[model samples]
Target: MTSEAPLPKPSFMNALITFGLIVVVISYGLFFLKVNLHSLMLICLMIAGISASLLTRCDFSTIRHAMSEGVSRALGAIFVFILIGVLIAAFIQAGTVSALIYYGLQFLTPSMLLPAGLILCSLMSVATGTSWGTAGTAGVVLVGVGGAMNIPLPLVAGVVVSGACFGDKISPLSDTTILAAISSRTDLYDHIRSMMYTTGPAFLIVLLVFWLLGQQYAGNALPSSQLLLMSNALNNAYIINAWCLLPFLVMLGLSIARVAAEPAMLLSSVIAVLIAVFMQDAEIVNVLTALYSGGGPGQTGVAMLDELLGRGGIAAMMWTLSLGLMALSLGGILYKFGFLQVLITTALRRVTSVFNLVVVTILSVFAGNLTMGEAYLSITLGGQLFSDAYDERGVNRSVLSRSLEEGGTLTAPLIPWTTGGAFMSATLGVNVLDYAPWALLNWLNPLLGMLFAFFGIAIFKPQAAPSANHSTPTDVSFKSVN
Candidate 1:
């Protein structure tokens, strides 16, 4: 139901039937039963367990172990998810988010807002190497601003996701970027450079489209009187100052320095809390409370503004965190029982030519994501599954790495059940289906990558290994769900 289920080592047909039933159940529940993702995931787990019990030869303990192993793979992401919530709360309490909105209103025209937001999210996600952080912080603020500007919420969310993922797909600091390279055994910088051929053009096109889209909203700009009201409310809620932005600047500097994300974010949160206390004169207890559960009904006194600011904190991330765990667990069951391997291996046999190989790799990524519902597993298994195939064809591993992120990282948020999709929906408050069409970069990059394969543009032959690269993957952080 949530991108993973109990697929056992049954024959291919049985595996297909097991998978199909889970999909049908999820579709039925979502389309008619109207169940939440977490609850539906639980049902999926139960269905998988029953399938395994009735269909597979594996025992009960093995099933439990499989699920646990699946969840363990996500520990790094879970750690960051918790930290991002705290960081978001600190930013809000420190008046950093308020100041951004207030200042943005003063300078940015309606026609420029979407483009600006796209660029802003791109920079933050690249700097932080975390799409979740960008979405939770900058994405939240932009949603508020976009709402005030009368832009469609879904469109704003799509732009935020597109930009956030663009950076997550290519940033040197990104875990997905690092993971893709490591998985394909390609040099990190080489992988980054190779992606430029495809991701670069795709992102530029996406930017252009968003710029054009911005023009349509030009006439729907927020009225000066209403803009003044929101700005006044922000001013009244907290002390808006240039100095309040220290946390963000600090985070940016640390990320650029490649000091791992966890410590950098934690340190930035501390700075934000201190600023909130000293500069804004917020109560220590209130600030701490906000850290745990967000500021309730922000003091803006305007319903819309109040709703925008009244977000963040550990509690807000719980739903996303829980869904992520369930997804992992479901993926684990299928993986442990060999369902995923059986199906993917069946598909890999058809790769006879370079173009066929490219198409298969991309489809395998989608297949792995759809089956496991976890991009990390998709990339990992995809790398393991297709590494030799790329070598046999004389293509460089960087291309394989590029394909992995192009599909695994970028499209993760397009699927409603994947953690990336779930996180975007939970954080940005838009359905994945609603934003998928507008998340042009996320979907288009893969097509462009495939186009390169069709023409043999940047796809290079294997190179001799020589130089010592220092950029090893130290932080096995979240899969960009990018």
Candidate 2:
């Protein structure tokens, strides 16, 4: 906690310089040098640590604690990452994924697939309040289906992400939703309501865009011959039937019932592995091997089917996990050293109106995501950073929370190094940059939010004067951001 153990306060200029230095490195390495995210993040971690030590003059022990605390805070997400890998492999082995593909092709057409997928993913994410789970399970199915239909995988991935994040932004079950509301000291439902005004419109627009674009690409559908080839390969490889769907149904049911994601996913994977061995007539040795390395050689002789099916496992997820760890540790150092704090504080001091406050809130959280390399930290700290400005301007707390989600929650997955981004890339098999252009809902919401703020549409009027005792939060120990 800053109140309990404050580091030497960093100057705004030093903080800005350090953050800029990191941005340059990330841009150069990510875009020009074409370095992998894991290596890029490692470089960043070292740079951040060194900068923090020089600017804040913090002891090595404090730096180590910050690094440890960063990863520790996100332990739940790390566990979920490992489980997602296991679940994907198990689902493929049990014919659950194969069954979906085999059956999905019977109904889904290239012309309507984008809009339909967006709606389905939206419903699932809302029900489960989990974007990652929705992306891992349903998103994977949609990507494979898109490929079978000869639709561009990046476009399909973008639509899937847009829909998955829609529920996460406004759903009551979402951790980011709850975190934003708590941080802003607003009612949970109030935060949700505020979000609906922007999220609803953005979602509809995204649906329309994908629909129109999908129509233009309908001609790209696979020839009937190729489609039949894929269908036959899947049919020959696994016992595709309704029984295969049971594992997914059970996982979805548990998630909607408020069971923890970890337990729900683990239980589902167990069922899937059992079905693979007994019902699918797969060898136990092969099943266990698939559980660790995704899978061995493909069951189907078709190159495309084999390629998609032969992915998942702990080893497959290591690239994402390692990158996320580096980013989190670097974020911990930045947060603890007060680099972000000084910059956000300086920015808040210049806010002069309610509209400015709203726009700043959105941009600050977006910047927080970039500098902190995670949405949780941005959402939590953005609340503390801007609550006073909103209070003084007579803006509703719900607006502040809505801004947090619009910026932090929506933008995190578009960045390549954030935990959200890494998970999406690993699960969906598309680079963030590739799909970012198509994930309209994620970017458009913030624009609409700012537009609404400008015209005063849906912006709540202040009902009372600013609280005299309102002050910066003292609970910013960074331990609770998760």
Candidate 3:
């Protein structure tokens, strides 16, 4: 077996200065100079790569190998991105998205739009196990519908993001969920169950907030005519039927059965394609075209309908894929050179109590998200950095996994340059800052996680005796905090 490289012990100040410089430059370029996110990420990667080499005195080949390893770790996530892109296109062509919108509109009144949007998006995301797909499809359609109702676009976007992320954070099909579980060496379902302690309450609170906000818009007039027009356009464009939902249901069932995400999504995409060909009467050439270009040209004459439905092909995911790869590459470089290990180790040493440890873990993962701008990287590295700490503290790995998701998965969408934030902004037509305040669940999750840690609500301790065969103890005893 190849042995691991020895990590350099750089001063904390040096690591901070290097990371801080990259953040400042990227932030200024993105916010002040209005530079493209992809370009900014590339710039940050260059800065981080150069800094690692300088600080660690590592040669180019060593840095390159580290970067390559990081990219390899992210390969699974990259494939999921590509598959979700194609799956989205298939959903559009199969008329599944249109059917969802059409049916959803019938039940949602203008006054209840916000809460209804949250519920719909949450269900869709949970079912599909993809926040990006939910955002691009149902999330986009809601924006158009909200526009017709004169509802605040930012509020709508916030609700959508909140719901989508909630589902993504906990769902079996979600890449973030799987990544967190694997990184922490915990069972997928166990990780998800542990998260429910925090996620469940946060989601309930967000629902209440949205419902209260909806009451303020209770007197707003519903745009019946515009909605009817869109509905008519949808009916005219494709075959809208219950069968269109079959692919989604099949995917959900597979996820529940613990099938791997890739195969489940692939099967779902195939089902959607078949539906488009036989039920929607789409030409095979048109289906192929949609698979490449997102979706076939919008047949709906309405501009909004055309814009909403005319998205999804494999090409649509290139921007996110590029950003993810670059972010992972930078993460790989940091990990390989021991920059991440040194930084995290420095932070971990200061924790003297369980609460402090949990807090530090949260902050460390948050920092990773800020630095790496990718959920998978943050979760993977956060788990790696804190796994030993949790074991030493007699804490369950589930708690560590939950903390990683709380810090990494929940916060990624709030950073403007991150993959989650960029995709949500691009797909939903709202700036990350504009909708962040309203994405209550995203910010609330971390706070709730901290609260749980402080109060010892769900902080579990290992059984009295360690298992002889297991590397880490599994049975946990729930402890109450003083």
Candidate 4:
């Protein structure tokens, strides 16, 4: 009798289990120990090292292979991170970033300070498709102005970030928004429209919060004297004009036209660099240097502008890319071992009712964001794990997408170590917690999501009946299993 060959061990199942336990550990660490990203990353790597050593029982080569696989999975995100850095640097060296800031500063006055700050930053974020860029440039200037006016820095920074993130979250040009849609496998326009349900209210609420916050200093006029200083600084630094906005317009148009992100970003960077050469007679060496080092300034007197504009070089992105790789490596190791699937399976079994399913989905989405610390993965994985349950309950695709946005996209910046929070904090020079309380949109989001989930508000269902060909015809459909 031929003996059945022993089944090969299921690595993904084991990885899923490992991932779940690690998630628990990370969540506990964050909540109870208040650990930071460096610590969290180390903890995850150590756990992964131990797991591989014990479970794989493989030689050094095998272990290295597993780690390599994990890191390899991170390559795409790493490239994007580096590209963003290069783009930031190119724009700065190209003088586009500075010109935008100079024009923004031209309108700053204490009378409409908060509203103006919000509007300008929001506009910049929408234009650049990056809240971090907006925060780094215009946001920093607003903070300095607040300091000059003896206003609280954190509060001002919070308002600036609020507006910046709001615009970034909503704008079609935003990479994160694109990532969210792509990962969810939804139409970009559809995703944006669906997001408005949560995003619109959050933005209105945040605007109100800023307006109220600004009331304390409502009568204070912007100091006219500083405007001249700013103008002189801009005049001395680089040629500034409406013409500088062409590259930005091109980028924005490309995004609006639904062009893919990587190519669009690259093309925009090239356009910006070309403009820099023509307008400023920028040396080729400076262009190349800026690509790597966030722009080599010939001689810009405004230190703040220099700092703001001189950001986003390829070299500068290494830190973010490394961190992202570490996170993805840990995620891959967990997947390979069986952590995530196990939790999802177990959770699925336990959630019997629609309310329970909705609650669990919201919680799971939050958990994913918290554990993964990246919005793209959170939305993708969370949508994958929960979509079927929603369908079974006759829930809508929009609801699932809404939940992903609420718990995944909006909550990401609240986690200090999460990619969104880390990028924003690093870019804006504000602590995650410092802005957490003030990120009105972020805070209200999960609650609104959960509310809609439980109340069954705004949840849409497909009109057709289920046929043998369709899994759940009446259920709302998602673009992907994720």
Residue-level lDDT tens digits of model 2 in 155-231? 99999999999998887778888888889887677778889999998999999999998898788677889888888
Tens digits of per-residue lDDT for model 3, 12-122:
777787678878987898779988777887887888778887877878887788778877876766676777778778888888878777776777677788888899889
Cα deviation of 206, candidate 3, in Å = 0.8
How close is every model to the real structure, measured as TM-score?
0.92, 0.94, 0.86, 0.78
Off by over 4 Å in 2: 1-5, 462-482
Worst 10 residues of 4 by lDDT: 473-482
Question: With candidate 4 superimposed using the best TM-score fit, by how many Å does residue 442's alpha carbon deviate from the native?
Answer: 1.7
> Per-residue lDDT of 202-265 in model 1, one digit per residue for the tens?
8889889999999998997677788888888888888788997898888878877777778888
Q: How accurate is candidate 4 locally (lDDT)?
A: 0.65
User: lDDT for every model?
Assistant: 0.82, 0.85, 0.78, 0.65
Residue 440, model 4: lDDT of: 69
Candidate 1 positional error at 396, Å: 1.7
- Cα lDDT tens digits, model 4, 298-372, are 556656555555566787756665666666666555545445555766778988766676667667767766655
> By descending lDDT, how would the candidates be arranged?
2, 1, 3, 4
lDDT of 4 at 138: 65
RMSD of 2: 3.9
lDDT score, candidate 1: 0.82
TM-score of 3: 0.86
Q: State which candidate, 2 or 4, has the greater TM-score.
A: 2
